[model samples]
Target: MRSPVEPKSAGAWRSQIPTGKALVPYLLLAPFGCLFAVFIVAPLVYAFYISLFRDTLVGGRQFAGAANYLRVMSDDKFWAGLGNLFLFGIVQVPVMLGLATLLALVLDRGQLYGEALFRLGLFLPYAVPGVIAALIWGYVYGPVFGPFAQLAEAIDVPAPELLSREAMLFSIANIVTWEFLGYYMIIFYAALKAIPPHLLEAALLDGASRWQFVRYIQLPLLRPMILLAIVFSINGTLQLFNEPYLMRVHAPTVIDSSYTPNLYAYSLTTANQQYNYAAAISFVLGAVIACASYLFILVSGRRRRR
Candidate 1:
């Protein structure tokens, strides 16, 4: 007598196994995906929805379509703000990154005394919140009673007014540079440390000087990190919020409501209560960040491939 065959559908077994395996990853990722949808995607969709309308005082909000976008395109203040940001980026980013790289190199060489203390001290400023750093620098930049002014007086020289309209952007840049130097330095120092010791030994055995070694070996190896830093720095320069916002209290005339794009959006949203237009500005700024970041990553990827 042939026993009834137990159910053994191969397709059923295969389907169940693969489906379960596939679902495990999604299950693990569910929390983050849900959070992103709730926080990031929902807000973006809401902002875009608001950006399509115009708030009216007499009437209820009216649909404006792309009118706000058109207004943004022609906005002189927007362009001026962008010009100021570009100037700040052009002048500050290279200087800050260069100084960070130099410090990282010096630290990586292991020649300096109190290297640990130096690293801690260098990184200390970054631990100070951006708002606090801005406030601290604002006090120091005070024309009469700030520490810098007092020092100048003690030395019998007039103090440079840092928050003057002519110098306000640069003063903000300085504060930003001070805050971020250690962060970039640590990034570069980590990259430097990752270089194989054998390569350094080979360079040394070939009678390469320290400068030559850094130029020929370290710099080439650091192209990726350099590109990374540039992308981050550019994104940061575009945002340009905390320092300017905090310092605006000290120099209201120099730092206006629209000192930068973020500040512009804040002014529109908080001061003018033009929620729709502020959303439009924020949306445009997001587009700019995405485009710029994509371009940088694309170029860097191409260079690496080459």
Candidate 2:
């Protein structure tokens, strides 16, 4: 039959196709979008709003305009804290990422025995809560009663104090690296695994040595993941608090109240009773992190284009 024309059938097929296509993208994005709005966007907006006001104990609240921001700009402690973070970022980031990349490569080698156990051991520290990690490491760094000191004493050598002002920054960085190295290693490993096996096989057939393969094949493939890991590490370093905070409680002189931006913000809110100032500092810190992340992404993208 010229058929009354299968209009309903054709329409149903057309509708189903579009619906299936639309559903996939939406379903993929739904969870992340919800979380982004709730945790990131909403809190950011609220923090920005809080930064614009002057909180008071007795008087009514009033808009401070940009006074809080200006105060933060002029505050030496804020600048110093940010500078410390910058210093940490410069020294710690490359070391951590390099180690992570190396570990990932080692683990990705099929010849490694007990690869799963090694990977688990490496990443296990990340599962520990940050506070607990900090506390455990804090005791380990204590010279008077910690393991290092005991070992040094047994060996008849002077115990190196990790909490000294001269070594505090490095000490904290070490703790951080120890805690997060495996986590980033896993990320790089995953990225490495995603590369096609045939590509490496071809490189090997072409007489490429291990270092050559790493430099030309593996590293190039890992560029995106490395950049992502760098961005995350920068953000974490900038917001460092728990390690220094716990360390400070153990050795007060080693880590000052304003050891990092987050610690400074905490001090402002709790010790100084300056919630408004704390909020303003937080907003500025957030802005700095956002800008730094954007710049890293931009530079990485440009390099990739080249």
Candidate 3:
């Protein structure tokens, strides 16, 4: 009381304390918020900051605002990698998702004899790490020692050049499909399992055949999951790197430095030591992923509205 500062009243002090459900949300979210700020936001800002400067022999590190981004815009290798991803997504995504859906339907029928074994077998490849999976497939696709090649020799037929330029696209697609098909299948299978028992009974009461039940009831319900799977597939396709990166050892001619956008960015940083440019390329890729995902969502939304 004698000092310049006055003591706060009890009500005023109580009012300052957080209480009830309002604070609960923030308390729960605080961990994730802290992690996002430290990990995600910090790196992105730092990378962007790094991307603004260019290293030069004459001037040393100097501000070259937007120069790296401009170079990325005209970069043929980046464009080629993007194109390759597009083509890969176009063919592989549909095939993979389609197979997953079919497998889910078959397994959900409850008629398969060894259902658990079947499911586990399908999902086993996905359990294998991507690098190991790529290496395993690389050996399978090897020209000389691979089973396919050896079989062809035994039969006096020409061995399939799986790692060759013409076949490399499908070859890599095959590995991706094999690895992730089970994962997507499990997702669809779980979705199928989650369908209400009442709906199945109602459909049965209505004299709906298996095919009719699937087409009308199951497919309609699964549309959302299918869209989700497609979006995930697109994202994975854009971020393609591992298979091609490892396959380089087997097919150096086909799997070049700029095989996919991720691979290209990695090569830029490691091989060319173009850290700033690589950062720009990574940001560019992030932008592409965001745009592609948004466009697909928009299209799906419109289609659903119809």
Candidate 4:
């Protein structure tokens, strides 16, 4: 049993501590909290406020309540932008994640020569800025001066019309896939490395084939990271902007003001100065992303339970 003096001493020590000292940890975090409140929280709140109004040159400005959201629901251009995102996400995400997983698996196997150098090389492309990657790939896809065109000319074949409407979305997808593949690869690779080696060794001892081990062991362990990648990809695809924005110059006809929801909102805010409507569009996009994230979490939870 503890002595009464010890308990009293502990209580006295705690009581002796200054009340202000209790706030030291929060005080340390104050700068970041202030910045986040000012930048992130303030903007979101302001945007929501703006979204509740109607802005027009003739009508000036008026409180519209949910009118902007109603307008967005019936907006054809808005749905078209969403359709583009849905198509892009549906096709591009799986391909990029699949390639990333394959590379991570290969690197994790430890059989490849110069594994560190190979891994570094695989990840280096992700270091390139999105704008720069778009420009580089745009140049490569250019119908006239691009090497691909020259190669086609030399072979007496037609240069691929990569900037055409039929292929523009896919061309943009290629750029996106190229830009992010290394990022997801590095993520999956880290997850793979974090997996305990003892489990793998036991599987090997049990005469598990490579496919059997990966299918039964690695895939299960990888589910969490895979879900994370899916969520990130979902957000990225729905908010697609940079690649398409940059590609607009090279493929102006195909890439227009309403190319993606972000671009559409941007055009409305800047070009048409429809700030309220643009805010509504932005909020809608955010809501869609939130719902998508929720569904993914729900499905993942169900799958894990099973």
Error of 3 at 75 (Å): 0.5
Candidates ranked, most accurate by TM-score first: 4, 3, 1, 2
Which scores greater on lDDT, model 2 or model 4?
A: 4
TM-score of 3: 0.91
Q: List runs of model 3 lying over 4 Å from the truth.
A: 1-32
> Tens-digit lDDT track for model 4 on 1-306?
124443455556655544687879978999999999999999999999999998776987889999999999999999999999999999999999999999999999989889989889888878999889999999999998999999999999999998889898899999999988988998999999999999889999999998999999998899889988999999999999998998899888898899999999999989999999999999999999999988988898898899
Q: What ranking of all candidate models by lDDT puts the best one first?
A: 3, 4, 1, 2
lDDT of 3 at 299: 99
Report clash pairs, candidate 3: none
Better of 2 and 4 by TM-score: 4
Estimate TM-scores for all models: 0.89, 0.84, 0.91, 0.92
The sequence of per-residue lDDT tens digits that candidate 3 reaches over residues 26-116 is 8999999999999999999999999999988799889999999999999999999999999999999999999999999999888989999
| Cα deviation of 276, candidate 1, in Å | 0.6
Show the lowest summed lDDT stretch of 10 residues, model 4. Answer: 1-10
lDDT tens per residue, model 2, 198-264? 9889999999998898899899889878988999998898899988899998788767888898999
User: By summed lDDT, which 10 consecutive residues of candidate 1 come out lowest?
Assistant: 12-21
Give the Cα error of residue 107 in candidate 4, in Å: 0.4
* Runs in model 1 lying further than 4 Å from the true structure: 1-24, 298-306
